[model samples]
Target: MLGEPAAMTENTGDTPRTLRLRADDNVAIVVNAFGLPAGTVFADGLTLLEFVPQGHKVALVDIPQGGTVVRYGEVVGIALRPLPRGSWVEESSVETPVAPDLDALEKATRVPAPLPPLDGYTFEGYRNPDGSVGTKNILAISISVQCVAGTLDVAIRRIKQELLPRYPNVDDVVGLTHAYGCGVAINAPEAVIPIRTLQSLARNPNFGGEVMVVGLGCEKLVSERLLPAGDVAADTGVVRLQDERHAGFGMMLDSIMTMAEARLEVLNRRTRETCPAADLVVGLQCGGSDAFSGVTANPALGHAADLLVRCGATVLFSEVTEVRDAIHLLTPRAASPEIADALIREMAWYDDYLAKGGADRRANPSPGNKKGGLNNIVEKALGSVAKSGTSAITGVLAPGERVRDKGLIFAATPASDFVCGTLQLASGITLQVFSTGRGTPYGLAHAPVIKVATRTELAERWSDLIDLDAGRIATGHATIEEMGEELFRLILDVASGHKQPWSDRWGLFNDLTLFNPAPIT
Candidate 1:
């Protein structure tokens, strides 16, 4: 169904064009980059009554007041007033519909049959002792409190400059610093989230199991607590800046660099081996979305997700607010009744969290989303859910929880790009695929993020930033299946270190943002 426009001009010359996803849909999105002006007519005889921006929808049929505005074969909104055919469907003229009731939904009734098993696919990766594989072999230094962040930053620069060059096999050294640990309610029941997130993050496969911790002696979260118990290597070391052994900043720096070199020695000996595709754990997310998101980028990403699932890989899709309005479509796809309940439970918890903050799902779509033609959260949710593909939801993870199962998972996290990426990293995703419409330069320091652009124009403009151009689907140049296949291959190439995403090539890594829901003292 992708790349098949319902109404299009015959010639390749500049003319008005629109794309309708389904036969019953009464609205079609304008495809021209600069938009079509008033009185411009389409091949199917639908004329524009007013200017409709690119990616914005136009009514395909006359509708009375309070009539439903259909897109993607679903009711996205209600007409604010009588809308004549050829009228541009502005965001203000549409009202969001009520979300589906959670308690009344069916459970696991329409689980999709598994796709054919894909075998003989493999990537070169580093195999850790704990049975997890890593796409990169890097020594990660963890911090227990924010107080040591500056000290760790200084030490990391020295390590990267003086020590890293000595180890050719080791990829890079990263200091895992965050805003948790001190000056907060560490004993609060909700405090476990950040604590466990920090603990799990230190064990990320990319770190090559060489975990080292740095701490200020008096922080509530001690250095030992941040290290993974029973999994830490005998040589796992911790450096305390407040220790009596450190007389000054110079001694503190020397201590950290000394510990870092030991970890690098271990990590440098690790080498990439051929591993099955099943070893991959990937995260799927989107931001700066537009109406074309569902039509192109998301669908293509969905197709790739399906392929990953078929290959026995673990794939995670998140963003609770983005999934809330589309929960109705996902419940029945749960692999079991238990999985369905887990999905609903996460949704309910997030609902309460938002309500406590005096916010609602309507607050999700940003101004960029609206300018990109996402009128409301309802419309955005419908487009956002397309990245899940048709795979059955096999597992669920609460925020900050490490993954225990290996399949299509719902890792509940906020919609913020940095926060979601952080949580996904904590959940053990070694690679991430982020799709955007309006464009973003988000990348992860611990993993490779493959950025996919929803429109060709943005991709062409930011050629160095975007890794894949799913926008070709909207331009009738590529099918979703083709793009999906290409993306899957690219994922393997990147994971194997055969190729590097633009973000990695440019070292455009974002800071680690911890989601601390508990009260901060």
Candidate 2:
């Protein structure tokens, strides 16, 4: 028999190396640097029956075949065979539970209690012509086809070296490049996904609605389709590389440079003005996840998400497959029956999408995810959902659609970290909070990503890289509430440009990947 749950102590170089989440859980995760060998006794008198790797599960009590294996107060899996006490619970020993049927899910059954309004929080942001607010003032150059990327890159480098210094208010020049725009079925019904993605990304709030387009002039995706209402101004809004008026390649580059300078002149006049927190649009995501993800970092970030919702800000949580196993857990939190239906639509669409590829949710929980102790998609989904906090889902966005309301929204996207981040950026997130238990150096060019660590070990190992250490909560040094409050303040400060996250400081950024479900010909 196991003893009662006791308060965990701080790391004093000789502390216990296990973590039990709940009193009823049948297993605990190994927290030691190297796992303990067989016969190692925990304080509760439970002895290890075998050598378990770090972050792997240790069975707490004897489990009969087909018995439930509980963790985080829910059944994560079922034992495939008799699991004796102290046995290592690897993926092979447990079987994933069947995903809940969409038709059986309840609607608005677990609505979150409205939190008291958070007042007076404000940030200095660039206000856009479309009424959206931007955390950074950047001049984005949109390209219609992949062919113009090389040319655009050269122009961007020159802009950064020469014109950028001239317009001090402009942050940096970004080429909105992608693999789409030609050599595909552009008019196919499914092609709308990537088409809208490029269109909306061009109008990202951080660009301040000052649009510019570069086209190869022969691509299927024309400049008119890429820009909004074909609204590019005559002076400097467009440059066509194939136009005959250009004498040579040098003229083409010079034409791009001239158009860029005109946009810079317009963007340089903009300044940051005080805006209420309600104007904020935040993207929430996770990568390189581990078991501690739910226990510390994600929960704390969820709390901050709830706080942001209370203050009337828009918070978007995405990654379709990451949430597929936990669809039942979210539908009840939907703000209305219509919202619940929208959630189901996104999930069902993804399921069909996967079936066409002859794949399923098992494709998730990457190797790093398994090394971080997530045995299957069921286990990963439970931890990933913690980032959403306890908020009613007020809206849902199809891939690449722009966000129009303020509240907790669900933006449906693939589980790939890069693709998810790109869709979120296109949906208009000004800043992002990314939690990790296994480490990643992931960053976005269009937004500031605040990397959060789930364990003290990773935080200490990569101190300069991590922005916040919610790992303190796991060590008993900080409560979830305290860590959440700190994160909320950090969001405001970072959005105000008063603080720069490591991703921003070191200029580490990943390219924008469009989610093109359409086929290539």
CA lDDT, every prediction?
A: 0.90, 0.87
Instruction: Estimate the TM-score of every prediction.
Output: 0.97, 0.96
Candidate 2's residue-wise lDDT over 9-91, tens digit each? Answer: 24556565677777788888877766678988777787888998877888888999999998876788999999999999998
Clashes of each: 0, 0
At residue 355, candidate 1 shows an lDDT of: 90
Q: What RMSD does each model have against the real structure? A: 1.7, 2.6
Clashing pairs in model 1? Answer: none
**Candidate 1's error at 129, in angstroms?**
0.6
Weakest 10 consecutive residues of candidate 2 by summed lDDT: 1-10
Cα lDDT of model 1 by residue, 9-88, tens digit: 54365767788888888998988898889999887888999999999999999977899998877789999998899999
